[model samples]
Target: MKRTQNEKILQIQNHTLVVGIDVGKDSHYARAFDNRGIELAKLLRFSNTAQGYEALDEWMRMIMEQKAKTEAIVGFEPTGHYWFTLGDHLQGKGHRLGIVNPFHVKCTRELDDNSPTKNDRKDPKTIAMLVKDGRFRDVYIPADLYSELREAVSERERLQGQLIALSNQIHRWLDIRFPEFITVFKDWGGKTAQATLKNFPTPARVMAAGAAGVLQVWQKHLQRSSLKKAERLVRAAEKSIGRTAGSEAAEAALANLLAQYDMIAGQRQRIEQLMQELLLRVPNAGKLLEIRGIGMVTAAVIISEIGDIRRFQDPRQILKMAGLSLKENSSGKHRGKTTINKRGRRRLREGLFQVMIPMLAINAEFRAMHQKNLTRLVNPLNKMQSVIALCGKLVRVIYAILTKGCLYDAEKMTNDMKRSMKAA
Candidate 1:
């Protein structure tokens, strides 16, 4: 079934059935076309159900029966989570599936029928034609356990982001209610600070409690040095001129926010447990963990996002996926500066960034590289840029470690790096 570049693309035009699916939440719309781009069947829309799946299967079966020699390729947009169910169903039936750019779909809509309009029916055919022209990649669904682990980790990240946002909000509230609170405890969630917030949400409440009473509250709630910090907090609260909000309202909001924070924290813990289990089973994860700054969570994030390292033949592909690759804008007369192309999997890029930070402090190779890049003649990047460049290099290092199944070596790596620089 192999063909030359042009031949492979042209071969799709001979396919018997081209199916376009407009995926949605509760239902999906499908349209079919023949080899000649002639609409064959009426728009077939189905619910997201067992019966709907059955109907979809029957429709494809009928098409196969009619054109025994031609193939069936289904195309759709990667519209968030809406495409997953349909994709799963298509995969289950052993039918070939393809995806089209949502942007491409939108641009082609007006020109497809020259109607200056859009609807579900026309979209399916256009998508099918796009697929027939070999304009899509077959989406990969990792094996079941890997997929579940990936989802769990992704959910944990989302929850963690929300927790951070709430914590920031609480910090802002404290600034208005008790400006000196930050000086007392750096974080609102600290043992001393949370207890203080829960006991005396407002400056007035702390004043009412007095130094001795506030100390007792801290002693009861926190196990720190006999509530010494708590006594200071109370004194600051009494002398502070920070604005006050209503006691009942303030208490309720703080309580509810803390409750949500705690709940999300628990979910994150469970996610970590699941990730630990999954990482132990993934091939060579322990070796990855041996690398400085690569923790269980960060390692899992990289492994899960990157699926099989074999898919990337070289480190550059991995770097590109992490959005660590540079984008150069140059013309015939003018040479433009190079900037990072941040157009890849954001989470993968973020995971690599997190890995780079601790590595900068612990990994000798990374520290050296960070220092080396800072001396560049052109626009030298800041600390963050150096870390990002290290992140790109880290991707290569990880690929080497995973593929070669060897331990990380700083000296050998340094020599190889020197050779590469000389060649460059």
Candidate 2:
């Protein structure tokens, strides 16, 4: 956790070789500089292959030998998945890698030539200079179980997006083809509703099938079939005001969506199992589940995003990483409302907020803390504000549980507010 600029600058001493790279999908550009920010070699362009990594290694070796530099510190913008392989290769070769923020690069690119001209050749130099000035963060490439968990979470997120899209499509189909379908069954994805949709898609079809026919379809999946519900479905179909045109094509579209929905549903279940299995393997990760409202998926997501909590020396880093840390916007005489920066991992932030809301609903300790934040005499927070404040507190509790292997203590989490009030 060498967080400060001085600590970072201290790492880049006289004998250190600072190499900056501009990473791309198929190619990368590299520029070398010393601690003094002096260019030591011409830019080297290479492919995104093993041979290219070796070539970059050789180039760095040649520069080190000529410039009397011993260790290499490589810096680059983490421009998506393009940098992961390169970062892994560089680190595996015994070189330390640093990630300069793209925003920082954009801001600093004009410092040298007073022009914001971004290119492969220009970015490497900009990246290198940033590294030389100690304006980069050390890279933490997760290994083994952490990697598996991260991939599992990412796959789950993708499947979740697809499922949402398919769900929306299904809703649209129901609205157009069978508007009254939702009135009978609140959830269209339910077993009974899905069976009805598969057997009778259109209002005309439902009317022709009759209530007995709808009950027959339901019995195939469920042990019990409701004739009364089926009769209601029949009545709605008879009184339906749904479109009759495009019925065939609409059925086909809904069939495709239903198929996709089933496939994605299966995939989501499988990925969740894998995520939980991977989560169990992580040391002390199960401690997170000890909390009242947190579940396997929530614990897995937090663990995956944090990627080995030992890397974080402080819980504040965790808050900042999750974008839960608040900042005040102000000028000399004018001030603005303080809010969370939201500049870190979006998944981490979203997961924390989502879990916190439910935690407030189900977990007594979190709810108490949230209530205190809202009703406290000084600087009381509103409902949503209290919820956001609790999110940061949850970050600390998670950090401690994973790093310290601590058990969940409602007393500590709520800070014994009852005692404080009594004492007062």
Candidate 3:
């Protein structure tokens, strides 16, 4: 929908220009209005490109000149990547920019026009009205380093998943070729097993090499393992009337799998290096790393997700952003359970979950709280549920540390422990 910047200006108690933009994949439809809600200009469309940016700037300038002395407030929906460029460009131009929620725009659109029909021009106006009412948030644009770190870490996660899948495929190949092999060795990717597999791709090859030849390979490539383990593997290989898969096929599959594994391992190393470098630059990263289980990767994820923690007015906002907010479903007669809202940034939620896992396992206070929350009539959360609840609360702790610039309070957990004890 297009916005009327003039209508926005007319409705404002204070003199301001409201430029509502309906973001699109390749272009943007916009409307401008004055504080009195008067339409000062007709509908305009511009390409979502560099030239389009220039055009938008020229048009904004013309509107400012026509209004003479009023300040300009540009508003647009958070329309995925399409709006990012425009938002960045407008912020660069020194214009005040606010982001309207797309959900709010959809609900408000029908209220403005009950017919449910929509046009690009109409949507922008609705967005501008929402902006004029102060129902918008300023977007956070991370610094270049944080952005690069975010991309790097995200790629690392993707590669890790791929590596796992490849490893699983290798396991499946092993099962088909030698079913009893895994019973003796847990992970085929371990240094000794990888060396064993590289040397003897098939059961027949291992049997041919016997115990002495197998120990030689392990000694050459994986020096840490004792000859005893190699002898055990040789014994397992000799006893097997294992599957008769072709030697050539098994060798080719093993070679391909190892190559992919090596590539992913290299990529992961690079990602870790980048993450550590970027994390060192973030405020209080050293303090965060000092917390057990919160290493450079975890610190990087937390910092990248919560860029410029000062932007949050309070710690609760960070909790809500991470979908850690509590939601109750109580009614007149039915007293329902409370659960997490679970409707915000996924990565933030994941980061908090990851952080809480180690804490729950090792931190004395967290373990006590979890057990204390697992009673019958007074407390109802199961072990798993209690852990999730602790993770949700952990969001508040992390937020407090970031927002208030406080140290990780090993003692602060006492409050939750006391509450659970009282409930029990």
Summarize candidate 1's per-residue lDDT along 122-147 as a digit string, tens digits: 88877887776666655667786678
Clashes of each: 0, 0, 26
Q: What is the C-alpha RMSD of each candidate to the true structure, in Å?
A: 3.3, 1.4, 4.5
Could you tell me which 10 consecutive residues in candidate 2 have the lowest summed lDDT? 413-422
lDDT of each: 0.78, 0.89, 0.77
| Per-model TM-score on C-alpha atoms | 0.87, 0.97, 0.84
The candidate, 2 or 3, that scores higher on TM-score is: 2
Residue-wise C-alpha lDDT for candidate 2, range 1-424, written one tens digit per residue: 7879999999999999998899999999999999988999998999999899889989999999999998999999989989988888888899998999999999999988899788888999999999988899888888888989999999999999999999998888788878999999999988898888888999999999999888988888899889999999999999999999989998888889999899999999999999999998898887888888899998888889999888888989888877788899999999999988888889988888888878888999888878887788878899878888778778888887888888888877566668765565
Please give, for residues 107-206, the per-residue lDDT of candidate 3 as tens digits: 8998766867788989989888788776776667778877877787788889889999998898888878877678668988788778877788677888
- In angstroms, how far off is 19's CA in candidate 1? 1.9
TM-score comparison, 1 vs 3, better candidate: 1
Best by lDDT: 2
- Model 1 compared with the native: what TM-score? 0.87
